[model samples]
Target: MTCMQLLLYSYPYVTRFDLRRLMGQKIKLTKSTIDKLPIPQMGARVDYFDTDCKGFGIRVSSNSRRFFVLKRVKGKLTRVMLKPYGVITPEQARVEANKAISKLYDGIDINAEKAKDNLKGMTLADALKKYFETKTLKPRTVENYGDLFRLYLDDWLHKPISGITKEMVATRHLNISNQNRKAAANNVMRTLRAVYNFANELHDDTLPPNPVKRLSNTGQWNKIERRQTVIPAKQLPQVFQAIQKLENPVIRDYILLLLFTGARRREMACLRWESVDLEAKIFTLMVTKNGKPLILPMSNFIYDIFNKRKALRENDYVFPGHGKTEHLIDSRKQVNAITQITAVEFTLHDLRRTFASNISGTVVGGYELKRLLNHSFGNDDVTAGYVIHSIEKLRIIMQEATDHLLMLCTAGKKINE
Candidate 1:
């Protein structure tokens, strides 16, 4: 057979004896040596070579460099280069080649088996797409997580989740903190911990404990003081009066709905008429940050506002818009509108914040405020699984709170007064 055919036929099966003979023969047995090598019938490649080595029984030449690759379980093939062409003697290559031959004879498909292993040490970016698929987070929340990963975890995402050290987390925190982003740094650490925890659950291995634990000790993670910007409970009447003077009926009802229900901006904007049960006096928000359907009882003002909205279409949203996903997209424009009319510098979110503020310190505990805001309490040993048994109590407080806002909006009600 021609040397080319010989090399093509035998490669990977080329024995030490065969190599010896070919090298000894001085016939430049390029194709002959390859033809004798024993390669898997299906996976054999033109430039590929695998040989037994001390640790790596199967070595594959990637880009013409010979190396010892450790492909454990089922994963992508990885290699450790043995020696440079001129650095290692041909005898060394032959010896290494023999080791690979030995491994093949032992009937181990290490290369192929390793190629099938689970994704370990994958970067954050590599696994995020998969992560996003199963998460039920709100769009804004999911976007925030994506932003954090893109901004902070670019270098570390590809790191095997198993290999992330506390030091690495601390270093990332330090870098972000040094950049005058203490809150962002803490958030990064928090995201890392959450991702690692998720990976640990998915992987069959134990995850390293969160490094953020140390951050808490160092006071790096601070309790963010909630912003309290709600129009006062007693200030709603004046606010309502001011709202009524606005010429746009849509803006009038929108601002009233927000002040009355204390609903999150997006939650109210995305509200479907189908999700509202006017007879039951409750509106259901299907996808909340806590991944639970939130049932919010409507106040008299909210019910009346919905009652006045003119609609007949079966699939019509309460608020329609061309913004993202067809719900009255964002409340920012409404916020700006209200600010221009009422001369207040508050965001729609600030309305929720105002709701929280007005409720707290007046027969409403932080825990109660959290419930109204649909926040999930931490899984503390003592607090875990403790259901909020105060929905009715919350409703009464919210009713009182909404009534208070009504008084504020109408307070200075004489048109321009």
Candidate 2:
């Protein structure tokens, strides 16, 4: 019988010995022997091992022949492809196979090493995006983080996180502090630290140690005192008068509501009409910074403001704006205008502080004050855990505080006049 006809006829019943003899027993794979290896059936592949190199072999499929190495790595058998037969010479494939086998014996996981290399090359911007995707962050917090990066670390956004050294972070912190932005410098570094920490944990600690720790290590961090400024009770009338002069009624009422209710800037900014119940004399903040729904009773003064806004309602937001969010995002310009007019400098947060400071210990008990502020109870506050303040009960305390505040404003107006 012809050689080709005999090989095809005996293919189905061929033993390893018979197959080896058919290929001339030259198992030490050379170009000539590899070229003579028979292709398997259309749907199958045949593995031919090299006698000279233990674990080095060639896979002959119906369509192609590829070089491969099989070895046990970390106690698990693993196969790694070198290159196609035509892409490299048999000698080159054997060299690469030996190198791979050495690495495997040394307990180096090649796949994991490649993954670590890829993560090490991740840019700061990409890492931040991955962090945002993996964590549930508030929109305001996300915006704040974006602002911190843009304002301080814009130059480093495209650079790989690994390239950011401790010296660089320390120098940047000093430069920002020299700009009279000590608080901003601290915030930017804090944000960077969070992003780096997230990346390390996400990538199986592939990244270097967090560079921001240098600030704490060398006392390079800025010591910013917490702002305790509040609108003095005597300045209430002047502040109210300045707010009333604002051309934008939306902004004026927004500031007034913040002062009276002590709601956070974002919570009050994103207030919806559906969340306000004028008839029920209450308002609900469906989404709060603390991730808790806040149901607050509207004081008479706050009720009047909501009533006026209802007649002039322009959209879903209580304080509508022309911005993309369809709600008031920032009232800084108007607040700055008021600050200029009255010379009573304050921030939006200061308004909340003013509300709390005025009525905290006197107008409401400590438990009631905590409830009014929607503050989470600490683990050590055993009394707070037992006390439950209902909205109806809080309405009385809120009205009393509002009355006290209005009296102060009226007394100030009389003195001014």
TM-score of each: 0.56, 0.75
Candidate 1 structure quality by residue, lDDT tens digits, 1-417: 654445445455666566445431322223344334344334332323333233332222323334343433234343434554345544565566556545555556645444335555455665566567766656777788888987988777666666767777777788887888878877877776676666656554455665567777676565656665656546455455666766655556666676566677767767788888778777787656566777877666667777876443324677776654765665556456656766657666766766666666774677666666778777673563665555566667667766655545555354245
For residue 40, give model 2's deviation from the true position in Å: 21
Q: State the lDDT of candidate 2 residue by residue for 5-84, as single tens digits.
A: 44555476676567556552328789999998876667666677899999899887888999988887767998887799
Runs in model 2 deviating more than 4 A are 1-108, 202-208, 412-417
User: Under the 3 Å rule for N, CA and C atoms, how many clashes does model 1 have?
Assistant: 53
lDDT of residue 80 for candidate 1? 35
lDDT scores for all predictions? 0.60, 0.86
